[model samples]
Target chain A: MKLTILGCYSATPRTDTNPTSQVLEINNHMFLIDCGEGTQVELRRNKIKFARIKHIFISHLHGDHFFGLVGLISTFRLLTRETELHIYCPKGLKEVITLQMKLADSWTNYQLIFHELTSTESELIFEDDKVQVFTIPLDHRVYTNGFLFKEKAGDRHLDMDAVLNANINVAYYRKLKQGYDVVNEDGVLIDNNKVTTDPNPPKSYAFCSDTAYNEAIIPIIKGVDVLYHESTFLDQHASLAPKTKHSTAKEAATIAKKAKVKTLVLGHFSTRYDNLNDFKSEAQTVFESVELADDGKTFNFD
Target chain B: MKLTILGCYSATPRTDTNPTSQVLEINNHMFLIDCGEGTQVELRRNKIKFARIKHIFISHLHGDHFFGLVGLISTFRLLTRETELHIYCPKGLKEVITLQMKLADSWTNYQLIFHELTSTESELIFEDDKVQVFTIPLDHRVYTNGFLFKEKAGDRHLDMDAVLNANINVAYYRKLKQGYDVVNEDGVLIDNNKVTTDPNPPKSYAFCSDTAYNEAIIPIIKGVDVLYHESTFLDQHASLAPKTKHSTAKEAATIAKKAKVKTLVLGHFSTRYDNLNDFKSEAQTVFESVELADDGKTFNFD
Candidate 1:
């Protein structure tokens, strides 16, 4: 799995810092998250192909979270894209985007699908043979949701020498990989474990942003291989966190620690802070494994 | 008058080249025109303060022309701006912008007034004591209008030496500046022309973009001091101009020459051409004085 941070700063986009937007590549799917203003330029700067973004997920209706969405859709139309695009966002976002398109009189030639999320409980939103996506309801000033992407385990690997020694027929190989015992060519029943080994362990990633300190999400994101949480403020501005419905570095670290995530990535930093290292140090005081997210940064997980 | 080009390229914005957006400063007023995506960041990069801009003029509803407007308004709200902002745009933009704000529940603290233009004829849209802005209707794929900003002629210069020689009283100086014949202290009538010269010829700038090769706007923009016109194509792609409702470089110069504009500035070049100098050479074939618009380039007219 590979994750690329197109932008990580908070509030309005500036010349040096961008707002919240990122790309996650998992199991041949490239998912765009929280496209803030200037996100298209950032994507171009990062050399990410626009054709690869088939699905986009918006956390909320905040301007900093999803203002770039319409521009991106318009660009897709200008490029004459033929691939269908899917958008998963809050219920009201569809109206906002469709209205803009209606005014421009520039409708997309490709199919545009919107998946509005209104459920307050954690539920599976998407599932395929190799991947599953679930929504983690978050507490914010508006209706918001974070997404959790998990990879499904693959089929067991066949022990070729052991299978040949057991005189297993070629047709039975498929059932053996499915962890099923089958009769060999000699008409003898064979154990599945003796001919195949276990598959690699699956990995999971959780993304949460623009939310207050809430323990309710800890269980939903528990034991995630990587957890990206928003830390908009540091310790000095801790008082503003609750008032603004944002999280401080220490609060994000506490959630990361409680969830027992293998790696914690901190992002969505407020532009007021001059030093990003301060957030890293503050988060590390509570959580041992903490990483800072900056614009154009990339992380790879095996 | 000082004009700053924030973005001048056509089509979608890229990492190095931006779409259409510019800042025009005339007679102490800063006017933002055609805010494409990433315009707010471009404004910051150019060091133009947000508070100085009270008016925005959008030529059309195309995504490259006005997509950044809502984000800029939302940023103003985040900045706690209390100054009123006025927007002049096509008829459908108000509904499109207000709906996004309503969905996000993020209304601006400042008053946002919209002046929807639907006239096919040239009309005055804004005027104050020192400046007047008129719409130069143009033909495009959508309803479009260019803006003509003309600085109202200032009061005639005092010509202090001539006034004092005529023994004019301090109380009559205001009348003298208004080009009135005023009685001097000795009760003698003094001629206005003898005391004062004509104020610097009122400068005018016409901005026409995203339009076809229509001669209807020639009369409205005739004899303007500077004219910024869209040249989306080169001579090689002249055939695509009418089909796309865009203008070629030579076509733009032809309009400039026929209108007798002092200087013609070509912008909105298609990204396919790598050399911008070719546009300048192509335009010079029809008009003697021509300039190319580039991102971050500024032009000052005295």
Candidate 2:
């Protein structure tokens, strides 16, 4: 799995910095997350294959988070995209997008589907054979949800040396790889482990942003492989963090530590500070595997 | 009167060129003509005071024409603007803006007045002490209206030399500037013409964009001091002009000539062409006074 940060600033878009948006590539699928203003240009700059992004996940209605949605959708229409696009966002997004289309008298030619998320409980929103997506309720001024993308366990791989030593029939090799016992014409039970080894460990990535420090979500994201939690402020502004319903770097790190996440990625830095290293240092106090997300930066998980 | 071209390119937003949007400063009022994507950032780059914008006039609902409206409005709310804003656009624009506000639950604290235009006949939309705005019926697939900003016949400027020579009382000077034949306190009759001259010949700017070569608008914008018309294509692609409800350089210049406009400013260029000089040379053949619009370029009328 690989994750690319297209934008990771808070508040407004600047000439140098951008707002929150990212792309995660997992299981040969591209998923766009939280498209902010200027996101399409960022996608162009990053050379992301925009047409392959079949799914979009929005965190909230804040302009810094999803203002670029209308333009992106319109650009897709202009490109004459044939594939259907799916959006998982709060219920209000559909109304906003349709209104813009109505006024312009322009609608996407391709099928556009919206999965309105209004639930507070952790619920599965998207699922396929390779991956599953669930919502992690967040505490914010408005209705918002975070997404957890977890890859499903795969089939075991065959150990060729063991298989050859066992003299497994070539016709029964497929069954051994599937972790099933196969019997020959002699009517003998063949051990599945003799020819097969365990599949590679599954991976998971979680995205949480524009939320206050809440302990309830720790259990939901327990042992996550990678956690991207918003760090809007440094430890000095921890007093104002709770009032704004935003998290500080230390607070995000606390959540990551409690959740036992392997990697903690911090993003959505507020415009108040000029330096970003403070966030990294603060987050490292609680979690060592901490990294800051910068625009056009990509992280690969193998 | 001063006009600033915020963006003039047609089609999608790119790295360098911009879509249609401009700011016309007439009688010390900043009236934003059209707002395409990334206009607010352009406004910032141009050093335009955001609070001074009291009115916005949109010619059509095309994405390139007014996709930046919602973002501008939201930014105003964030900046804590208290003055009421007036948006004059097509009939369906209000629905789009209001629906976006409803979904985000972030309605402006300031008053948002909308003057929806749906009439085919010329009609007055906005009138102030210094400016009177009227719509010119346009031909397009959608219901579009071009706007004409005419400076009202101003209060006559007092010829200071004549005022001092006539020995007019200081209190009566205000009456003389109002074009009144003021009788001196000493019971002397003073001719209004002798003391004052006609206030700077009521400058007018006509904006005609996203329309085919429609001659009916000539009478409405007749003798305009300056006409800004969209030259989306060159004469080489004139065949595609009418189908898209756009105009070529020659066509725009022809309309300016038929209307007897003083000067012609060509803009809304299609991104297909790299050389902009072709438009200037082509339009000059039909109209002698022609200027090209570029992003961040300003034109002043004296």
Candidate 3:
């Protein structure tokens, strides 16, 4: 799995810093999260193939979160893209996007499917054979949702030597990989655990942004492999965090510690501060494993 | 009068090139014309003050022309701008912009007034004591209107030598500047023309873009100080110009020559060409005065 930070700043986009947007690649899917203004250019700058972004997940309706959506959609039509695009966002996004298309009288040749989310509770929103996505209801000034992408556990690996010793046919290897006891060629049942070993551990990533330091989410994201949380303010401005419904570096670290996440990625930084080292330093004090996210940065997880 | 080419290209915005948008500073007003996507950044790059842009004129509803408008409006609100903003665009733009504002639940603190244009003929859209703006009807796929910013004829410059010689009193100098025959101290009526000359010849600028090579607008913009016409294609691709409702460089030069304008600025270039000097060369063949519009380039017209 890999994560690319297209933009990680809060508020408006600047020449050097961009607003919230990222690409998470897992289970053969490239999911675009929170497309802020100027995201299309960022995508081009990062050299990410536009066609690979099949699904888009918006965290909120703020201009910094989803303002670039309509322009990207219109550009897709201009490029003559025929792949069906799916948008999972808040309820009002469909109306906002369709209105512009109607006014331009330029509809996309491909299908545009919208999964308007209104539920405030964490729910399963998308699932496939290899992965599942769940919305982590977040606390914010407006309706917001963070997404958790978890890879499903794979089949157990068969021990070829053990299967051969049991006189098992090649056809029975499939059953053994499925963790089932198989009948051998000698007409005796072979135990599944004796012939098969466990497969590689599944990895999961959770993206939580634009939310306050709420401890209630710790239970839902416990033991996640990687956790990306919004730390809009530093400890110096800790007082402003609660008032603005945004998290400070210390607060995000606390959540990561309580959730016992393997790695904590801090992003959505406020542009008021000149240096980003304070964020990582402050987060590391509370959580041992902490990383800072910057525009055009990429992280690899194995 | 000064014109700043914020973005001057055709079709979609690229990493290096932008779509159609320009800033025309006439009299005291810094009027923004045709705000394409990424225009706010271009404005920042060009060091234009956000507060000075009180009026925005959109040529059409095409995405390349007006997609950046809503984002700019939202950024103003985020900056806590309290000045009222006036937008003059085609009829359907108001609904498209207001709908997004409603969905984001972010109404501007400042008043947003919309002047929707449904006219197919040239008409006055904006005016003040120093300047006047009129629509330049153009041929495009959509209902489009380019703008003609004309400096209203100023008070005639008083010939102080001529006025003093005629024994005119200081109090009646104001009347002479108003281009009126004044009664001198000797109770003699003096001719206005004998004491005053025309003021700066009333400079005018016409912006015509995203249109085909049509001569109907020549009479309306005849003998204007500076004329900006779209030249989306070169002569080699002249066959595509008529089909796409865009003009070639040679065609633009033809229009400029027929209109007899002081200077002709060519813009809205297609991205297919790597060399821009050819456009100047091709246009100079038909018109003596030709200038190419490039992003971040500024032109001074006097």
Q: What i-RMS does each candidate reach, in Å?
A: 0.9, 1.5, 1.3
lDDT of 1 by residue, A1-302 (tens): 98999999988999999999999999888999999998998898999999999999999999899999999999999999999999999998888888788777889999999999999999898889989999999999899999999999888999999999999999988899889999999999999999999997888999999899999999999999999999999999999999999999999999999999999999999999899999999999999999999999999987
Enumerate clash totals for all models, in the order shown.
Answer: 0, 0, 0
Better of 1 and 3 by TM-score: 1
TM-score of 1: 0.98
Residue A128, candidate 3: alpha-carbon lDDT: 91
What C-alpha lDDT does candidate 2 achieve relative to the native structure? 0.90
Which prediction has the highest DockQ against the true structure? 1
Could you report the Cα RMSD, in angstroms, for every candidate shown? Answer: 1.3, 2.5, 2.4
Can you write out model 1's per-residue Cα lDDT over B108-157, one digit (the tens) per residue? 99999999999988999999999999999988988999999999999999
Q: Tell me the tens digit of each residue's lDDT in model 2 across B1-302.
A: 99999999986787787778999999988999888878888888899999999999998988888888888898899889999999999888898888777777789999999998888899999888999999988887688888999998888899998888888899998898788998876689999999998877889999988889999999999999999998999999999999998999999999999999999999999988999999999999998999999999999987
lDDT of each: 0.94, 0.90, 0.91
Q: Candidate 2 docking: what grade?
A: medium
Clashing pairs in 1: none
Highest lDDT model number: 1
The two-chain DockQ for each candidate, comma-separated, is 0.85, 0.52, 0.61
User: Least accurate stretch of 10 residues (summed lDDT) in model 3 chain A?
Assistant: A97-106
Error of 3 at A231 (Å): 1.7
Decide which is better by DockQ, 1 or 3. 1
